[model samples]
Target: MTSIRRRLLLSLFGLWITVWAAVALTTLDRSGHEVGELMDAQMAQLARVLREISLTDPQPAAKATPQALSAVGHPYESKLSYQRWLGDRLVASFGVAPVTPLAATIGFSDQEFGGARWRVFGLPGNAPDEVLFVAQSDTIREELIHFLTIQALKPILWSLPVSVLLMWLAVGEGLRPLYRLARSIGRRSAERLEPIDGDGVPAEIRPLTAALNDLMERLDQALAAERRFAADASHELRTPFAIIRTYAQIARRSGDPAERQAALDNLIRGVDRASRLISQLLILARLQGEPRATGRGVASLVRAAARVVADWQTDAQAAALTLTAAAAEGEPGVVAVPAAALGILIGNLVENGLKYTPPGGWVQVAIGSGRGSVALRVTDSGPGIPAADRERVFDRFYRPPGQAQPGSGLGLAIVRRICDLYGLRIEIRDGADGVGLSVLVIFPEPSGSPKAHPP
Candidate 1:
């Protein structure tokens, strides 16, 4: 149930206590040695002093006068002691325990004799005194060692709880940045992918924040691309889809042979239009970062559009639609595009223009180059897209509002996708004094002028 901080504090506290305990034990041993030496020295000094005092006076008797001896060695109030001896008998004393084993030899402070414990030391007297002895106990040394051990250990034990509190505060402070990041993230919605500000984040957490921001940017781009695709597809497919439905209903209800055949023809054309729109949708997918469209080699815009235009003329004439091609004489005939892709690019433009133009309306295709670039244009005399809807018309499956054209709406999307693949640019605008829409494609003239493959 103990937390990490408490556990660490306890561990440290226990280690410190163990260490100090060892130190205290070692101190006790040393204290015994020093106290023993001090007791021996004091006892020796007292015994020698007693002997000198006993023998220094003028005395003919070998033994000190009993009164004189007693005066010198009565019980001293402090730990000090002195005793006098005859040849083999105790004569006078100071602080003498009743059962002290005081003898001729120097004695230890822990000796026992009779019925009591004593500390005693004996020394030889001068000319007249036979021997003098001194002794004291170690009670004071034991009390002092116990007091020091208690004082030194009290502070170390009491400091652990306070140390644990400080440690918890530091840990929480260190994690404050993470808390801030979490709160910031919690405030965001699923649709919000804006990058978070990473300034002032700790070095250890910077990479994490940066990674999340990168993910948000990618999600934003993906969502935008998806929205664009949906809007574009909805716009492009609406026209033909309506045409197919209307003609189908007409065919279903009509009993007149000629009217039914006309409705069937319109329905067939609607199917073709739907097919073209679907193909353009596929191209748009390719243009949106697909790997298959990568590295489409360059070709001549003149030759590429010529082939597409020729095929479109066969269809345009069959539909009683007018088609034309215009190009500069002996000028550069090359455009930067892949050969196969070039056909789809021009064919879609020409076909769309022909389909939307009235029976007599003309579709003009042109190719020309100067100033390090080639320009390809498809111009038509059909009802042109309004200036306001020019950009929107380029969206996949998009047909301008109120547009009555019977073609797939993806013609411009196909044109835009191809342009992107070849590093070309395209725009739709009023043609020849704002007559009908003219779709323009400008291709960059590459250095070393890439050779055009024969189509």
Candidate 2:
């Protein structure tokens, strides 16, 4: 493939050659015609003046002297020659025209004298009996044009070398910034995510460097997240795996049915915990690139919470805890949400409430609105989170102080992902009347114009 610079140079070169060719041909045609006409007129004029030599006056050679030819032309430049018919014999000087051997002696016409061609005039005014002829060479026309072409082209041939040098310098100057950017990247370690120094960089290249820096930052985060995930997975998997191993050993040692049954129950509990942790991890993974709009009724914040709490109530009944939801009236029946995400949010909050609250204490899921945002509040009769740890609660695998619950710690991470996706805000605070923890998820209302489509 040809480079752009070479292609541009070739195009310019072709144009210059074409222009010079046209100029050469046009100059040759115009100058040749003008010079030829001027030469022909001179010859005619010379012939007329010579016919005034009166041979009938006895000594005509007196007026044909070299000084007498001074009125026609100089001796060196623009050659002029003459011929006279001295009694049917021809005379001549150096001329380019070949002999016109059969020309008639009319009043004014072309003729041949000696060995050269001539323009002649047979006159009856001054001498009724004589004819005169004169001629000049045509080589001066070609000589003048050839000299002009050489002078015009001399500078052009020399300027091409200078032009190429200038072009080389300009291209290097233009590409200097690109070379600097490459050098900056080349000097960096692969593990680093530091920003590029944008000072002295051109505005045209700033956007490219900024984009590369952004990509590096994201790569750093992704690597960190992967390490955290591996550690968290190992810790979570170790618990259930140990319980299964212990239960298997016990079942093998015990021959009685009752001991085997006890071992089976331990195995089941271990499996349940493992399953929940796996499900929560799966949720976090899915939420890495989760799609947001689930427009179903199940995606409603209050409804989803009510269902999750209903399930939690049945589970907590065996542990002497009460689970319930307190939905506000006159609120929109079903808000648009991502259902998988909303379920994760509602499930985590309600479970935390049930776990921390004492038996006979109530877990309330409330929905209300104020200040252009709708609120989903989960309040309970449990020890509330500390102000310092409240900010950190949404982190993956994080637990509040004095917490004893067996969890993978990914619950609030899932919840926070949902909250971020739905534009909802999460807060952990003392409940109304200062008894327990309150986690409220505030959602912004749709723009008062919900568009619909046929299913």
Candidate 3:
């Protein structure tokens, strides 16, 4: 695996090396040019000095055979040579093969003599027929250039280790914050969902830290909700089971047939209550577990409400209550919800209303669409919820005091959860004459293709 720190270090080191290489190349080039210019100047100066010496000589030597100068001299002097031409005769020569007119051109020139390349500077002699030339072998200048280049690069080559060490240290120091953040996360307990501290964190990584904190907050809430649900379920189910056991014992001990029958009936009622509570508990759990609605297709609110009324018609009649459903005329009565979700929502509301309302009372389920909103409203001619108790009614297993109703108190809670999942808005108010409860669920505009249907 490739490490981030290693990559960063390598990138920085490569950049530094590249920059140094460029500078070194430029320095070497400049040093070669300057050294060449100095050597050329020395050759020209030697030529001038030879011309002056030949002009001042009063007894010029007679022309003789060419002779090689001594090999022992200053390290550079052995490479130097001079030639003088007087009227087409070699008057003097040193350290090199005799050659007439060492260079055909006048100023500075390069020529091969004695199997070696030389830099030659030719000067006009004081006498019109005399010519002077001073030449140095190319090897001498190359040696000097090589020496100077090595000297120039010594500092950079020697400092490389120190520079690399410093770079490594700097990179490590720069990354300390990230290391601390990683350690902080690694040290956390699994159950600890608290947000991480943002203090001392680098600005570049703030977004990452913020996202982590947001996720932790959400997880904390979910865990808390789960814990609360478990506690409530255990507490609520305990009571019904205890009553069922008590009634069963009473039936076993009773001697009169009618008394025993009454005890059995109570036991059955207790069992039924426990069964309903368990069923509601499972439904609530499923509703919480399922993913939230995406409003993928339009569901007919009128159809869902009418279906709930039809299914509950017998129950309504058994309770001696009139339950009815209607849709507004000339409206699609569509909403952005699934058909099953709409049915569950309406069914819970109508069931709650039927269970609470007195005999001869009415429960109305209506679907209306207007003003860019679709609403499913359930009105019951029952004792209305007090204004203070409206919000608390949505809590799990919370029942109002002084209400002698056989209920698990989960119907409205389930409806509220469904509304929250689908982004629906619910409102509670007094029914007609302020004597009953009115529950209204408002949904956003219909999504996808909506099909109109009658109630």
Candidate 4:
């Protein structure tokens, strides 16, 4: 596994090392130049002093030895040498004097003498043909330069350990918030779905926490919906099963054919009601779990309505009701939705209309397009839902007051859920005569114009 802390430290240290190396190289180059300039100045100054001394004392005492070139007699004194020439004769010498002229030029030059490289400075003497020369060994100057460079690097070497310690501390402190967040999530109970607190969270981590909170909120909603579904299913199915069992017992005990027939019919109706409730329940569950569609296919409102109307036609005739389906001429009536979802939405609406409409009443399913939307409308001549109950009717297992109908009260709820999934606009209002219910499922126009096809 890759570690953020390790990666950050490695990157930071790598950059630091690169910068330090560059700085060290630049410092070494600059120091070398400065040291060479200082050494050359010293050699020139010594040569001038030697020329003045030669002029001040033309002759030396017979017993006097050549003065040591380095007055302080330092450890590097042996590398320093000087020579005084008077009229083609060597008058005085210190250290190892070269057999040949140390420098042919007037200023300074590097010359090999006595099997060693020397930096020599030559100056004109006070007398004609008199000259003085001072030189230092190249090996000694290099040793001094190396010593200075090491001294200059001492601070960086000494501070490295402290800097690394501080960097490690800073990295750990910066990552504290992430560790806290992980611990907080790990400590949470599975049943808890509350939003996480954003206070005290680092700005960089706030987006992550916010996304986690959103996920938790959605999970809470899904669990709540599931709980409500389970409770409603048990309550609704209990009544039908009880009724069926009671009627079955009555049918078994009855002696007369008429009584037994009535009991059997009631039992059958209870069984049918229970089966319908279970089927609708399954559909609602499936719809809740189905992933949102993401395909280019278009659903034709006209075609879906026609198919629903045909399927329910026989049922309408059995109920002694008039049912019809029609599409507005010249209207595309096409929407961007899966055909299966559209069919389920239309089927529920038509079924609800047919179930509640009284005998001899009329029901109509119509498809029309207007102003960037396609509308599939189901109108029934049943007693219309009151304005106050209209919104509530779409809630699962919510039955309107004083309505005598054999239903699980899930038809409109299913329609509402499907409409929400497809982003369709659903409206409930009075029918054309203002005496019945009309449900309008308005679908937004498809992104591209698709030819309407039959379902």
Top-TM-score candidate index: 4
- CA-lDDT, candidates in order: 0.72, 0.68, 0.86, 0.83
Count steric clashes of candidate 2.
Answer: 1
Judged by whole-model lDDT over C-alpha atoms, candidate 1 comes out at 0.72
Q: Write the per-residue lDDT of candidate 1 for residues 235-301, one digit (tens) a residue.
A: 7678779989999999999999999999999999889878967777777666675433434555777
Q: Evaluate model 4: give its lDDT.
A: 0.83
- State the displacement of the C-alpha of residue 53, model 2, in Å, after optimal TM-score superposition: 18
lDDT of 3 by residue, 250-313 (tens): 9999998999999999999999899989989998988876656757567778778878999999
Residue 23 alpha-carbon offset, candidate 4, angstroms: 3.7
Show model 3 residue runs off by greater than 4 Å: 32-70, 73-149, 178-216, 243-276, 282-344, 358-365, 369-372, 418-424, 433-435, 445-455
Candidate with maximal lDDT = 3
When sorted by TM-score, best at the front, the candidate numbers are 4, 3, 2, 1
Q: Which of the predicted structures, 2 or 3, would earn the higher TM-score when compared with the native?
A: 3
Runs in model 1 with CA error above 4 Å? Answer: 1-197, 200-219, 231-263, 289-296, 329-332, 383-389, 396-402, 420-422, 428-437, 452-455
Judge candidate 3 at residue 321 and give its lDDT. 100
For residues 416-449, write the lDDT of model 2, one tens digit per residue.
Answer: 8877766667778888898788887777755452
Report the Cα lDDT for residue 49, model 3: 86
Q: Rank the candidates by lDDT, best first.
A: 3, 4, 1, 2
